[model samples]
Target: MTEITPRIPPLPRAEWTDDAREVFAYWGEPNAWEEGSKTNILMTMGNHPDLGKVYNIWGKHLLMSNTLSTRHLEILILRVAWLVKSAYEWHNHVGYGLNAGLTLEEIGAIRDFPAGDDWNEQDEAVLRSVDELKNDGVISDATWAILGQYFDMRQKMDLVFSIGHYVMTSWAISSFGVGIEGGADQIGFDLRTASGKIPGKTYKPGEVEDWTDTRGY
Candidate 1:
């Protein structure tokens, strides 16, 4: 994994104010501010408690109440993490993905969809939609038709919103340089070591036109 010095280091527990504590409380038992807590993303959000609180509300919905199946949700999340190359997001979701029932080979196959025989028709459509959204900012008609065959209107909406949410999340995680939590379970494939088959341009910080070979499929 690429080492990133946090541009906005996680706010220490001692510095957490009442608002921050309340925001952290949303995660339930063993409050995030308590000792031994390893939710670095929430800790980083502590820098802006108001944002944390609201963001948590939206995130909570996606994680806890979304109409999409756990398998599909994790698939979307892992794909976005791979597309954006957010190691922190990727690492955390790898555990979530596994727990949600995706096998290691299936998780690894997310790096390049349709290249392996791990996915079914619906699963393949979901993967393709993620790539389409990433590259074109829209899901193509063909992909939408495939999705319509299996997902309801609500599920489709959740699917798109979930992708957009994770994309935004990956941006924040990368920009904030949130590192993997301490003692995090060693599960899931690391983006640094995963092989990617897709082609896309790589942009350096602050250099719009000066890009190198395609990276982060």
Candidate 2:
């Protein structure tokens, strides 16, 4: 079950409308490549002007084309979801994460990334890279070295930007009181460290993620 003690509460159902339902129906379709439920809802809802712009830029920068491969991108997103305890994001991405080449165990391990099990050297590198970028505002020497073996500069750049971007998305949804899209958890969820603060601004000050950094990451 989701812990909906949101920093912001959901808009009342009365406020939900035929237009909103139309938006929801369009999103519920699996037309947008490999996106599952919550991604579709989040993507559709993000179409609401300012949030949409950020979503588009973030998507183009990280996911629209070749940044990190889809597989790796999914990995990063799942890790973010797990770390932030963003259940909607987690259930939505885990399906894609598996389809994008991550194993079941790998997806499960994401729940405890800093100390996940069965990880190969490469896997560990990616997870740690995410940790470094999220925590220190830059990649670490240790992680960069490992990432270099598998990814080029562009991939590295995209990977970092993707992490930075989704941290914002997850933060916004969590803070703005977006409900987890229905059927999101058919993929299921693992309640990870909800207290693990993201390194960016989450709607409220002194909130989970601080958005003060000039650069996204």
Candidate 3:
């Protein structure tokens, strides 16, 4: 594993101004700074406050809206993260996925979904949609019909936007070399850094396995 480094490191907590603090507070203090350490994603975006503010609005809607269940959304998110090979996105969402009822085996199998029997029909549909979106830039009609069978119009819409959000997020995090949260390990680095190495924290496969299996939800 390569050493963890951030090409554009996050703003330090000590440097946050009143307006910056207020903006972070809108999302929740812990989201931007936790136990005195700034969250890399938010801090990186914070460098451009106006852009970060607008992104926060859309982020809040996606996270808070009840159009989709946590489990379903996590399922959709994990698949997109894995397909895009976004170490940052995948590592962070591993905890969210577990809390939302995804098991370790299910989460691990996301990288090669249909090969395993852990996924149900709905799960398969969601994963299939992610594969289609990532490879083709659009979900195939067959996959769309499968999704339509189980999801409402809003759930379907949420699904598309949720994938879109994470796809862009992965690109940003990878491009910026956003560091992982302290005490966390990076996964899927080989794929994430495919374009070029920007220097981010990377952990050994063994270390990442231990980290991934024990996030404490």
Candidate 4:
């Protein structure tokens, strides 16, 4: 897809200050890799400099190690990305989703999963929970029952925050025009114009129409 590239600062990793270098070292990265994580590292470490010192490492650790598997994390992330119509996020994370065993059908169906007969029980629950959370800032009891059956209390807690955190990230990408820097493939989600046949129209922030009480964490 043709996209208007957003103007952002080039990464400044080589000219790091002593403090930034210390932060980088604390994260256990003395070197950089060319593929996969370069853009994220550069964005989180070098570009987003004003953020919290260990924001990069700590945020990734929360998703990678704590809340859930990379598979489930990618699920919520891709869904949120699609909701926001973030071509950058959808392109970047689809490969990660595939590597984590999410099928092309699964990835494609996330945009309006409520109408699609494409997801399993667990996948549906996860997607629906994220769907409600993003649109309404809460998960309904029906969806929670589905998630609670599979995830323990800790996993469930982290799962909640993980979805919210990713919504924060996707919102930043869409609103702040944080352009994706690497090889970006287009998933071409048309969020603005509803086809009138799928799950629903685009999800806009601050327009969540409903709310439901969720469990702790």
Candidate 5:
């Protein structure tokens, strides 16, 4: 990958005032404010605090509250991130994807999925759904049927919104030239890394390779 230089460099920390501080605090500890948090995106969005607040709220819902399996969600997110060339989002989520039970091969295979033998039927369906949404803005009936076999209505809806959400995120980060968070390249997120300090543990795939909310929702 070529080097990416942010056209809109993050606002200097020195410039952070009350409102900036509020947005910073809004995202909260490890995931948002801790030392190596992916704050570059947050800070860039922080340039406009009101927008940042709402964005973070929706983001929290997507990352934390949605009913989709973390494995499936990560698959959709990473695929969109790769196709859109949003290295910032891709780099960060790679760890989240791994923690959510995607093996390195599975993550790498996302680049050339359905054609290869790497993906199982459900995985193929998820990736195919992303492809359809990315290219055609609609999931073909065939792909939807495959997904329906594994996912319920809420999960299907979550898949659509998750892809759409990441699509917008990629566009914004690429257009704004947002770089990775400070010091991320030196020690970025990895398999051992959990997705920061969520109140509970990150979701792990269960016996059926389906997700069960450990927290009981």
Candidate 6:
């Protein structure tokens, strides 16, 4: 894919105000404003510090405090990334998915779910729900019933909210033209090399070395 310039560039670190610094610091950091976020998404949002601060709370819940298991969360997130064609989201989450224990085959399967034989019953249902929701704006009765077999009420709610969150995020990333932090080569999805190893850095779970302070969490 051709590289697209960011329509709203990340707030240059020198331009960050106290509010932007605080918002960027929410990812648990050696001060994101000082050291920079692992990804450009946060910095782009820094252009509007108030929204970034409030948005981080919700995003942190889904990523760190939600009921869905890491595996399920990554699966759902990857599916949304593919559906929305958000390369930035996909590039980052491919590493997160691997850390969450999804095999490369499984991660690739997310591109065309149910077409591959990797998913089992519950996993398939979760993947299917994303397709249904994206296509119909609601989960079907059959899919919901299958989801109920495994997830509790809270899990169900989190699943839907997670989808919505990523969808909204994809919109923002694409609209803002948020490129991969390093360059196009860092993008995980490549039509020319779909079956190859995914690019970009991978972190072990809870490997926020610089962001050690969880802020009392």
What TM-score fits each model?
0.82, 0.66, 0.78, 0.70, 0.78, 0.87
Residue 183 of model 3: what lDDT? 46
lDDT of 5 by residue, 1-60 (tens): 345688777657677666655566664443334332246676776678778778878887
| Model 3, span 44-128: residue lDDT tens | 7766767777887888777667488888888788888877778777766766676677776677687667675567778888888
Write the residue-wise lDDT of candidate 6 on 60-102 in tens digits: 8998888999899999999999999898788778777877788
Residue lDDT tens for model 1, 15-34? 87888876766666243446
Give the count of colliding residue pairs in each prediction: 0, 7, 2, 0, 0, 0
Better of 1 and 4 by lDDT: 1
Global local distance difference test of model 4: 0.61
Compare candidates 3 and 6 on lDDT and give the better one: 6
lDDT per model vs. reference: 0.74, 0.59, 0.69, 0.61, 0.70, 0.79
Q: Pick the winner on TM-score between candidates 1 and 5.
A: 1
lDDT of 4 by residue, 1-217 (tens): 5555545543565756654454444433324332112344344444544563556665656655765777787888888888767776676566567666777667767776777656788888888888899789899999899888988998888888877777776766665556554442234464221223222222111123320011000
- The pairs that clash in candidate 3 are 4-200, 4-201
Candidates' RMSD to native: 10.8, 11.4, 7.6, 11.5, 7.5, 4.4
**Which wins on TM-score, candidate 2 or candidate 5?**
5
lDDT of 2: 0.59
Q: List where candidate 5 sits over 4 angstroms from the true fold.
A: 1-3, 13-17, 30-38, 186-217
Position 32, candidate 6: lDDT: 61
